[model samples]
Target: MTTITHRLPQKRHLVTDLPGPRSAELTERRRSSVPTAVGSAAPVYAVDADGGIIVDVDGNSLIDLASGIAVTGVGASNPAVAEAVATQAHHFTHTCFMVSPYEGYVAVAEKLNEITPGDHDKRTALFNSGAEAVENAIKIARLATGRSAVVAFDHAYHGRTNLTMALTAKSIPYKHNFGPFAPEVYRMPMSYPFRDDTGVDGVAAAERAIGMIDKQITADSLAAVIVEPIQGEGGFIVPAPGFLPTLAAWCRENGVVFIADEVQSGFCRTGDWFACEHEGVIPDLITMAKGIAGGMPLSAVTGRTELMEAVHPGGLGGTYGGNPVACAAALAAIEQMSSLDLNARARQIGEIALAALSSAAESLADQGHGVIGEVRGRGAMVAVELVKPGTTEPDPELAKAAAAHAFSRGVVVLTCGTYGNILRLLPPLVIDDDLLREALDIVIEAQTPA
Candidate 1:
């Protein structure tokens, strides 16, 4: 229960293979200066990481189960978030908290309004990513509920700008060809209990997603509903336990500003620092960003100090919004995730990754190698989902050949959903439970499907 030992070497070594030879010469100098629309699901080149490995540059150590996408939950080089981002980058690294102002951006907006999930009189702001804290939490819920239609669900993603890619619902590589996106933005239906076939519960999947948000928008023209209280990339989808307190009690009886989007399941990575606090469901605007700054480029929103003072003090900010060295690496990664409770180490890494991926999906459907249709998640945000054996369809090339054979046997694993077929995982709430059960036995021997 003390795990934070760093400086690499946790195990799983490998040596020279998966993009080896100095990461294939930096992936051929990152394919002549990056941008084949910037891919990289892992073709290895890291160089060095910590807690749960990641070395690379052909040296090869691997084993980090995708925490970078969940933003290094107090790991990748976290010596108290690299000495608070090297003492806030030797004094100053950007005076821009909307042009000169700091105290590490008001102590990271008083630590995201005293650690998120409602006490009531909350308020925050800070942003830089999670699509600028979800386009400023739909501009403070359409300027404190004057309303203008917003909703968003069905395999939702909610980021990649242009009003979070029109509140993302996936269109190959996050709304491909970007498109005529930012409009009124409506989409619903999501209580995905392993591909919902109508045996509904969770308040009948929140009354069939509030009957498609009251027949597609007009609970007085919405304003904000934006979810993801455990639906990252939509495959780690955990909806049905009274579907987010009956869609947050019908967005608090139609005033509509629910907005969770705890960007990749907020700090402590889902073992409840906020996955809408496992159904206590408070969100009246949350939208944080990948583990709030252990991997900088911070983001936030918080809310309900009358909907974050309903905009207009120079109508919300940005000029590197709140960058005093990413609010001193998010106040030293939220004081090393609340002095390393890391939300009970993300429910003990989600009860050992849901009992080792539910016993490797019941031993790969009793050796029929059924392509694991589900595994689900909670703390330490897990996933699995490949499908098509007895047919739940999706198998994204067997989840990209079981994450390229668990990154050629060293273990890195990431993949996601909206039919990319979800591998997920997101380790590092201070990893090392025997190197996370030997990287979940090399992701159940490289994603089963033989």
Candidate 2:
């Protein structure tokens, strides 16, 4: 069913029940066919999505707060984006960028160079997913630095590919049965202010991690040190103020490249154009995806020109890497983000969201039954890790219950983190104050003293 919602005062129509009788029947059928993990997030299937709401086959409209896991920065069904995609599709689709060079793909590269951080000459190679971008970054670093070892922080999530899985911190869902990952991957503790004690502050945490690397993986043997300015699935963690700069300085001093994985926190999702901009540390490579092309499957690796040149001719290319249609959509999405001041808008949304959720946590703290252990993130990319209390313990039960309660109503939220105890909110920046407040109400009610 196609959804029609124009302008403000968004209308939510639930012609059927939450799952409706038809959807329930379809879901039952799905159990026999599809893997159960498919429906783990929201059992209710999405029939249609537009603006900031998802309409189910049962005709239940849900206010989307997950933004497709922070992929759709500019609303779900942007008219301009739709027009761009349609226009490009009518003309042509694929011509492997490496085989037959195209203007659209080159234009995207030029745009990435101009938009990405740093005044140094930058180069970009388009990819199909965040994992691809990350893998490419590792390859680039290895080739440029002529080293085999890479240092990654604990709680970091790069991607799901073999190499990326080795880089990823958690091993439950992403790396459970899969074995024998890429070599030269090292994981170290992060600047988790919420967890550490003693005087091991944020910069101190970086120092500690760096000290370990200095002793174990010498800079002479390391290719790069990959990090996330604001960890996405790892509890929405925001590292200490000087952590990134300190690490970057160490990398520069030791002849190791610094790669920032901004897949989840880039493209205006974190108020800044990229989370790395929060600090002026220009990395040797930056992997980006998610909101890069609005809702389209687009990812890129922007890097120093000389470093990117290390790759051999025909070393990197994909048929769908820069499909013209997706490129056109990306152009429109970037235009929308700039003209609409979405970066500033992201800050506004984040400020309001933090205020509301933090207030709720404080209220419960007074009662000694608080679940929101900590609220941490930058700009609109925010999360609340639920815990029993006074401890860093993960509260998966509360998080699951909160998510289910939101789904039962009309709000769609996503639960993430290694522990699956973080309630992540990625509402479209276009969401109205009223709708946002209403969604907040649902969250509060779910955790209320019922």
Candidate 3:
């Protein structure tokens, strides 16, 4: 793989305290301007970023482990993506594909069709966000199958949109009091090995979910079953082996559309182009975003040609879906992922991060600071779930404390999960080995009990 040289210094440097004077002023201003509901994990305001480092306004260089919630996998300021965006903007910004159309949008669709799982004839539709892609995927499935009910799994987080809010499981924050959500969405048990009280293996757990569908909402009423191969906001839970394959097979037998929500785990983030490839489970439809366009806002839903064609031409579209500049960025980002062999790079990162985190968890347990319930996740998208020392009870306070600790020490870490007890690490795929190890050391220190 070719080495990626970042413009900024790769190491973390604290020139001033986190949320320094400049950031504090911005925070004060933001409190009055922006709504309180839109929370920010890091208090510092970023001036620039590249590779695995984010430079704040106060001249603090912090290690970036969150990758802007799994976007920018190629890097925050990849030269190719930036150049493409600039070139596209120079030519023309938005002609609105629905109006005049352009080659960039077609090219992006072609690339998505080629890269997404399944060799079958496929079609692609671009959107502005992951939630939009998911919503459109569900719309296509319903129209194609002539069914109303859609099934989502436990601990799943689709998005914040009203329809997606109903699909999401957690009550607090994401779905709290935001009721009268779209109907016909059903929740089923997921194959979460760590939290499974039944102690069932992958196949049995899938059977349990299938049984629920059989009893409550039969297959005939179910239009599609959407799932994240690796649950993202839900603690980076990788379902036990055979779980995804069993569900996909069942969906096929029942004529229900199977949609893989790869919004968080797609684009070589999980040591594969998509996490479903890990299990060889090809979905009829797949939703992607996050890392698709470097840091540009772009999302897509790629699916079987027939299923996608079911929607009338005018039925699926938005004003800014597949904006020209974003498509250009996506094309360049995909090329970067291919030429740099980021899939292999992600595997290497996984090995390093998992080993370090696992060792830390063991050390903490031996020292009787056993808040880490489980260290899990694949590739660069890794996390450790925190729990009460002796029991499986969640310890969200510890997760928050650890994240705060990391931030204070010049590392940016993110916490997610229904209970907000999992510390997730999503470093850029191009992060240098030395820099990654240094960041991991700081993360280890932050996770340690004080």
Candidate 4:
């Protein structure tokens, strides 16, 4: 197939093996300098990336379906975002918001407040990462409500920080041996419609969870209830239809601050500015990162004015909470997203990918090797869970093999899920339709049994 011409040419071309000689050499050098703990699925050294392609040092072009873990919604090297970063770097790089406030910081905060769900008076606090934003959100909630316990759902991946680690439910790589973690965080059942054998609806899921919370944790003792609108690292699990709204309503009635951790699903990745908007669920606070700055390190906690104001001025800031360059990039990224209407593009991508994947799954199922257990997601964030042919048992080996096969064919795919049986696709929102379809085809072909 001919490569589509773009910034880096949206195409997949294998000049050599998957981790060609150049990448292998770099990997050897990296082993000596970088920690073994920091791992990556795509074992290649990227020299240039743009649109939907990541070019390695060996001249291999790989279709990017992961989008740098959903960071580059506009694109990996979006012209506007790159220009903004370079321009800001030329003027000034640091000058942290707490040390010397800049217009860029305030402007980005304003944009976040305006775009996040709800028109009620809200405030924004910038942070360096999703973990920091989540930690601060808990701090604010605890202070405002004078409560100790916070509720997090199962199959949740908040972050890796101490508090977030406590909130996260994974055990192997994320939370394993990282304890003793932060205290007073409780875990509850999530509304995973796909895995729910009882066939519970959205409202039923919410009621079941609320019953547990009421029985275990008293209303006045809880500080907040935090959840991902669409659980990202936890298999891209999308809660049932009415689950989020029901939970948000319960939180409001009980005065527990409701927080939507949109780190992975925000910024038009899930067809909406924020995933919570899909169900009209208005949270007291929203934690954002990943796609906020077009791949730059920036995050935020935007919330109701009253809850935010409850925190003292000096109580909620870090040294580099809102670096000038990052804030500038965020402003440009938001402008680019709005101008390009990336939200609609995300929805379009979802429609095409979902239909194709559903059809493929059905065909494979008829063949008696029904590996795809479920295909779920919204917008550009989609996933295919691999399971045993005749049972619901997770097949991590099959998922791993499919991802490896796609990578060998010059398509970058990411595997995730608590059981490591999910293949997630998060192509850049600005990806060309042809390239997107081509990448999806490669993945589907890889999953087919020999």
TM-score of 1: 0.39
Tens digits of per-residue lDDT for model 2, 128-166: 999999999999999888899999988899989999999
For model 3, the run of ten residues with the poorest summed lDDT: 441-450
Clash counts for the predictions, in order: 1, 0, 0, 0
Better structure of 3 and 4 per TM-score: 3
Between candidates 1 and 3, the one scoring higher on TM-score is 3
lDDT of 3 at 160: 94
Q: Local error of candidate 1 at 117, Å? A: 26
Q: Name the regions of candidate 3 deviating beyond 4 angstroms.
A: none
By summed lDDT, the worst window of 10 consecutive residues in model 1 runs over 1-10
Decoy 4 TM-score against native: 0.98
Instruction: Answer with 2 or 3, whichever has the higher TM-score.
Output: 3
Q: What would the per-residue lDDT of candidate 3 be over residues 1-450, giving only the tens digit for each residue?
A: 588878988988998988899999999999999999999999999999999999999999999999999998999999999999999999999988899999999999999999999899999999999999999999999999999999999999999999898888888889888898999999999998988866698999999999999999999999999999999998899999999999999999999999999999999999999999998999999999999999999999999999999999799888899999999999999999999999999999999999998999899999998888999989989998999897799999989998999899999999999899999999999999888999889888987866
TM for candidate 3 is 0.99
Show where candidate 2 strays beyond 4 Å. 1-16, 37-40
Taken over the whole model, the C-alpha lDDT of each candidate is 0.84, 0.85, 0.94, 0.92
Comparing candidate 1 with candidate 2, which one achieves the higher TM-score? 2
Candidate structures ordered by TM-score, highest first? 3, 4, 2, 1
